[model samples]
Target: MPTTTRSESTQAALLEAARDVFAEKGYVNAKIADITGRAGRSIGSFYNYYDTKQQLLRALLERFPAQIVERARDGLSDDWAANIEAAVRAYFHTFRDYLPEMIGVFQLSMSDPDAAAWWRSQRAYGIASVLALIDAVEQDGDRIGLDHHVFASAIVSMLESYCWTWLAAGGDDVDAVFDEETAIHTLAAMWRRAMVGES
Candidate 1:
């Protein structure tokens, strides 16, 4: 049990280090040696843990979405639209919580095919949730709205755009820009416009 705990701890550290290096240098330019150096381990030691850099990179790309979903689940369990809004907010807030890691992920997504795939999956999940929200809004079947999928796509695009801007802002304190209140305001505004056709 103790050995497993130690392995888990070290794996987390290595994952963090890989994220940093991958972000700064990208997959093509990032070296296994650099990752190992950042993790304070030798090449052989890194091999002992991960089979390859691509696998590690895949793991790094996947870590945050799962975390965001978990946090959303914890914080959002009420109404569906409200939960979606809360989930979006929670994701951005969590992104800010790990800004440096996020920057790396963004950078990787730009140049690495694997990273791009991971990013696409992330966006797809958000878009799917927004579509679900649209369904809930139309549960009455009045068709009393614009095409929910269209609106959902637009909203998801808007959100990802904002997040990309935040990631690139390079401010000393990025998290301050995305507090709970900011999320509530932006998400609520968009959702209200979509569901009620006010905007």
Candidate 2:
């Protein structure tokens, strides 16, 4: 294995420190001083890796798609239901695992055009995956009587919003608590039903 350089180590420390600070203080409120202080690095070291906190947050956000893809790769099959279930579970867990990045992107996207565009691009990535799934299903001689693009967009939106509502924003109903398995199954069932009219 290649040894990690001091520069790489410092960059990793800064990224971890930023995640912690963003989690505790919210992205908008977190300061470069806080991140550097937590990382035991100088402010100048931070500038060497990232020019702004937004750039650091973007670096964190970049990991999200890869994590989702890796997690969703397991248990994939010709069966659409199984694929949908795996994808839903992967998304839910990844959202929870990377809550800081999700929170940072959502908060910054409101005022930052670049962040907003990044957020949209992330959603588009999900949409594209769904569209590919649709293509595979159609190639298997199944007909979905809807516009493919709209259907894929709706599926991605549902997954994104539901994950945000439950995992990030807390559940919508205070009295209704859902376990992880239940939530994943419900979302997967909805997606599978919408696609092929059976769960």
Candidate 3:
């Protein structure tokens, strides 16, 4: 029992350390030695839990929040405007909470096929939630003239690109300041207006 407890504790330390290292150095540039050093564990200990850094990334992705899936599965609220705000808040919150993982996926996906697939799956979850929202709006008797899938695609892109632009890249202009409330309100307003014709 003591051995198992130590193993679990070591694994948890490794995972947390990996997140910090990946956030600081990015996945493409991070080395196994860096992760092990951050964890204060021997290099061999890493191998016991994960064969490669890619496998560690897979583990992070596995634990990625399933909010989108849960939202889609649970159905949306009857209050369309409130729902818009709620969805936008949830999206931004997720991005903030998992900024490092998101950055790792974005940076590595460019060069790694597996990473690319993982990134796509993340987008797929957002798309699924957007589709469900659109369906709910339609069922509420609003006519969404645009192709629903395309609209959902656009909405997801807007949310994702905005988050990446401000959160990850720190926005284009150095003088511009970004905050959580403004970001959430802007995206939520856009989503609400786009779906219901007024913010």
Candidate 4:
């Protein structure tokens, strides 16, 4: 592998530090000082990479979908059940891996219009993927029996909310923390059932 340059290394450090800080303190409450401190770099160095915390957070968020796609690619299959399971598993792992970005984007989106728009764009991407899957299923003579657009939207919403609730928000019941495989299987089964009526 090609070696990373000094600038690239510095930026990587900053991003990693930002992720940790965001996870611990959240986007709104996290400070530049904290990130810099965690990164073991001066505050000035952070600006050399990103203009603001929002920019850093955006960078992280941009990686989320691509990571999921990459992980899910190998698991994708012609079977609808396998496809849903693969997608759900990929999303669950990616969400866990990028929990900090998930938390940051969600918190920032609540107050910033640009952030909110970005969040919606992310959801739109998922919705489009779902619609494509729906089309494929229909072409295979499998009737969905629901409005394609609405079904796509609802599926995306369900995946997003469920991941956020369990992973980021810790769910409602403190005693109910789920194992990774169980969570992924549960989501995959639910999604598969929604699409084809049997998990």
Indicate which candidate wins on lDDT: 2
lDDT of 2 at 27: 92
Q: Which predicted model would earn the best TM-score? A: 2
Please report the TM-score between candidate 4 and the true structure.
Answer: 0.92
Whole-model lDDT per candidate: 0.69, 0.88, 0.81, 0.86
**Candidate 1 segments exceeding 4 Å error:** 1-9, 19-30, 51-54, 77-81, 140-144, 171-180
Candidate 2 has its poorest 10 consecutive residues by lDDT at 169-178
Q: Provide the lowest-lDDT 10-residue window in model 4.
A: 170-179
Rank order (by TM-score, best first): 2, 4, 3, 1
Q: How close is candidate 1 to the true structure, as a TM-score?
A: 0.72
Q: What number of clashing residue pairs does each candidate have, in the order they appear?
A: 0, 0, 0, 0
Each prediction's TM-score against the native? Answer: 0.72, 0.96, 0.88, 0.92
Q: Check candidate 2 and list the clashing pairs.
A: none
Show model 4 residue runs off by greater than 4 Å: 174-177
Off by over 4 Å in 3: 1-4, 67-77
Better of 1 and 4 by TM-score: 4
